[model samples]
Target: MSSRSTYHHGDLRQAVLSAALDVIATEGPSALSLRDLARRAGVSHAAPAHHFKDRAGLLTAVATEGFDLLAAALAQAKDLKDAGVRYVRFATEHPAHFQVMFQPDLHRPDDPELLAAKERAGAGLRAGIAGVPADGRGPDARLAGVAAWSLAHGFATLLLSHNLAGPIGEQDPEEVFRTLAGLLFTSDTAQPPQE
Candidate 1:
């Protein structure tokens, strides 16, 4: 279904974003347009322009929504054995947003909403890292974030790129993710408290 919008509608922004997502899902990033989104939303073409100056603004909104959702999902799995697995789940479940988020050239990260969303996503990831045992001020700390982000990002990227579908072998994605997370979560040395 297309989106619906009304200035007074509580969910107008969400409706617009959702409709944009559907459009992106079927048409891919290149086809996104504020006018098209407005059409889908059954709102005036100029209406979206107000919320999103152009395509970048629209994409920024999508990315912000995605980051916010990702942060929430990762936070929910806080007590789970591995937050990285939650990260993978977040990426898989929100492929469209995840797709828009990383492709900076496709969306303007400087957009206020986009920046806030990016910070939230980064904070969520750092929180996940913080839950894990690690310490240091330089290379080691950087490694923790990179390792966790890379592992999750790599898994999500590979899955989306369809490069790991068969090589992953006889296991469901979640099972595989959990198993991988366990291995990755294991530090080379004993767990160290965050500094």
Candidate 2:
């Protein structure tokens, strides 16, 4: 059977999503269009429109799926450091999804499915943060969670953008991320800088 016929058999929505991801990976999100996705999926131009309604709808679906995937990855992490490494791996492996997941302006932020998936991802990250001990145990824990997330997210973004390629050289990104995560989350006996 032809590709279009295959889409008719089943999984058209997933096919369209996969096509959109390929397009985004190759040409970036700005280049994404429902019509183009339909063409890539070998479906009638109206087929994708029926499922997604518009570009924003398609992006919302992508964002939701992205967050779900991120939550699963984060959930597998044994601790904050492992979570950091997993976050980087997820971003690198799913660059298109990772890009859409962060740029809220591109999708319907109020979509129920999107919000739920976002919450799951947040909870997973928070769980990782909870593994770390803090003195205050209330406000300090919250602050530590935010800092841990920021560090991981920033590191992943920079690594994917090639900002770390020069300084990192051939060293493993996982090891590097683990080291950074440890320094930030774990206690160290280093002396403080003073004037």
lDDT of 1 by residue, 1-195 (tens): 233434444565776888888877767888887777777777777777777778888888888888888878876766333567777788778888888988889888787877887787787777766665544423565577887788888988888778887988666777787777777675445645679
| Span of ten consecutive residues with least summed lDDT in model 1 | 1-10
- List clashing residue pairs in candidate 2: none
* Candidate 2 lDDT over residue span 1-195, tens digit each: 575574583788999999999988888889998888888787777789788899999999999999999999999999888888899999989999998999989999999999999999999988887777655534476787888889888988998889999989999988999988877677533444578
Query: Which is the leading candidate under TM-score?
Result: 2
Q: TM-score for each prediction?
A: 0.81, 0.90
Cα deviation of 139, candidate 2, in Å: 6.0
Quote the positional error of residue 158 for candidate 2 in Å. Answer: 0.7
RMSD of each: 5.0, 3.3
lDDT of 2 at 64: 98
- Best candidate per lDDT, number? 2
Where is the poorest 10-residue window by lDDT in model 2? 184-193
lDDT of 2 at 145: 81
